[model samples]
Target: MARAAGLSRTTVSYVLNGDFRRIPEHTRQRVLAAADSLGYKPSAAARLLRGARSRLVLMVSPGLESARDTIGGDIVTRLGQLLAEADLHLVWQLGLPSVGRAATDLAPAVVLVAPTEEEAAFADLRRRFAVPVLPAFPGLGGFLAASARAQVDHLAGLGHQRLAFVRPAAPAFDLTAEFRQQAVERRASELGLPAPVILRVDDSRESAVAVLRSLRTRTDPVTSPVTAVCAYNDQVAFALLAAADDLGLAVPAEMSVIGVDGDPLGEWTTPTLTSVRSDTAAFVSDLTSQVVALARGETTTVEARLPEQARVVERSSTVGPAR
Candidate 1:
């Protein structure tokens, strides 16, 4: 019915929200008249009693997620801070398509905190339901590319040429892998260095430890062995550190390691971790601003591609070239 009126989804949202401040008087009257004809009534009594902003944001994530990982915890904590500051309420939910979770229960909006979408049909979830469906990181591919470039660039600056990356079990929605690999290759080529190799392991401490443990027994220990690592996450970096200790391999001394996600666990490692950190605060600020702007029926032309705030905190993890 709103579509038939030749109004935008946002215009409809404004009418529903009852804040027709900017809506032209005639159009407001038409919207009201249409509502009257259609028996569209908003119960002020119910609204006053409910005391809830019909604004509910549903955060959809991958996996059953019976538990939250370390990065997940940090992101949630940061999101809560932003949501509170923005005077918004949030509800987190798993993005498992099999769960049959109903978006209908959410009052106004649904946000999927995913890198990418597998269910293409859900692209119109907003159009059909008068809600907003936002992909968290629109510049996700380039972000990953920059992240990979950060480490390689760091190693290149330090005169280390050969690097190997240890990755997590490739999540179905991994948008970063290819761009990151390409960026690594491109950087290596421009620097006249060999391309770094990627090694994938499950997103677990044990898997990370085992992969690094195996690398220590390299057959070509004399020459052309990987001297540096770009781990997928901070946890993987922790495992690599632990394995290096167990295998008696020197960090940065024998092998340098850099991790992504800027998880706090990276700090606790013995040698500390040289990591590529995300501009998470900026991301949350931009995301909340956009989502709220989108909610309030205001026009926005902002495209946020927050850059990688890559900081190479050298404690003992990374060092000068292998001499």
Candidate 2:
């Protein structure tokens, strides 16, 4: 096969084993075409018998089948690059049901990057394969709780006494968002800020607009307005900002908004979103290191603690509330 493709045996092996990140794109294509023409397939059992490490990592994306690339592309890309350095390969499995003990037949570790609700189905995968099942979100083992804490602290420090947390009604099992909301509530009480309101808005621009309308409008002077909002993610934050604009409200002046996930599109918004962003480099490194350790029957303190840092990225979307 190596001779047929005019490439070295190691190069062919890398391509066949899905560890071809270091291989040039054109060369990879040639190797792939050769293998396709020869009807060749790499057998996991054969590699294992040869004393080769499985080197495969399966990432399960539940309820994000259609938007995994859009939502998790950055994290996945960085994770692949980091793993490839150690000759490990990462592959994504869509839908929760597709993940089970059978998945460990292809990899030694599984990364679950979905909500907590989908976790139960994979409990058997952990018990059956003895493989580590890691969560990549902020809450539940990642940096989400910290991200929410940062968002709340930033807004409260700016003198926004009354705050709100906004999330979509769908993806009811999005424990990441749920954790962020809880963090905000806890932080508010700790800071002596007014109790924050939680709003489950429909996941649409129009729904957000309507929600903003009701919140920002109150004829009663005694009603303390919600001066700051922390959205579940950048998508919801963007909607709220747009809705605020439609109502002719002066952001940061009359109201402030912040969100999580640090989506690149947030920077392009009219007022540039202020967000609580994941420490991508640290996150990828920690997750990769922990999974690699788990694969080797080694344990790390990271398993019992959150491994990523969350910090606020200030932008035009926030300021001290009006007196």
Candidate 3:
């Protein structure tokens, strides 16, 4: 094990003893692997006989039971993998009732999820947890603006001038949506657009389609009805496509559309969607790194960063302006 890790026996022994001082992430990974291979387990038998459990890190959230987003699931999967790879066990627990402290006693290091924007989850996690906190999202404007800019640039290059965006009314004032709107507007103006259009809809796809239908029927004062549109996600983007069809409009010929999220459904749609592809690999990788770091009894600070940028994925849903 020591030979594989390129570490002296003493060094490997130190890591096996849970003394992680002065070790880089790679080195730590190597030593952990080495110890596992050599079966140098942390003896609970010894610790129990000694009257103490080996302290470990834990992931503290408002309520693991209430986090129902697929995105969140993906994050947890990656995090679990990273922790396992590091010979660390991840424990997820909820702390409610108290807004600033966990209900249960925990290990010294904790990973509290503080999303970038103000969220009920963030409030519960940050103020309630007794350990280090890691932010899930980026610091508002910059990330959102960048996401919008990248999308807008791609659509414009595809001959989209009269473009639109579809979003739902956010009760919490979504920083992501706000950022995109601002960036879309600013960039459109600099590019000589009269005004960038945004359509608000209820959360449902049906409502979003109805809004798109209303938008399609309007007289576009910009010399052209919007020929291209952005949907909040691939589902809505596909709904917009259906909305155009219901309105007797031909896609790309009469209108074109794009969406965010490279959801698997996007590819199966009649016309595959052009979307902002999420680098799920990178997302998972970073999520794993962060969570495992926390699970290993290491401190996760506010600045523990991960990539959140969305990339464009081109497909048949978009086409050049009518020939």
Question: Top TM-score: which candidate number?
Answer: 2
Instruction: Identify the leading candidate in terms of lDDT.
Output: 2
RMSD for all candidates, in order, please: 8.7, 6.0, 5.7
- Predictions in order: lDDT: 0.65, 0.73, 0.63
Better of 2 and 3 by TM-score: 2
Query: Candidate 1: which stretches are off by over 4 Å?
Result: 1-45, 48-53, 63-76, 98-100, 113-128, 170-174, 177-179, 203-206, 219-223
Per-residue alpha-carbon lDDT of candidate 2 for residues 67-109, written as tens digits (9 for 90 to 100): 4122367877887888777556788776767566546457554
Pairs with backbone N, CA or C atoms under 3 Å apart (clashes), candidate 1 = 252-255
The per-candidate count of clashes, in order, stands at 1, 2, 4
Off by over 4 Å in 2: 1-45, 48-52, 63-73, 100-122, 128-142, 219-223, 293-305
Q: Rank the candidates by TM-score, best first.
A: 2, 1, 3
Off by over 4 Å in 3: 1-73, 91-108, 117-125, 139-141, 170-173, 280-304, 308-310
State the local distance difference test value for candidate 2.
0.73
What's model 3's TM-score? 0.70
Q: Is candidate 1 or candidate 3 better by TM-score?
A: 1
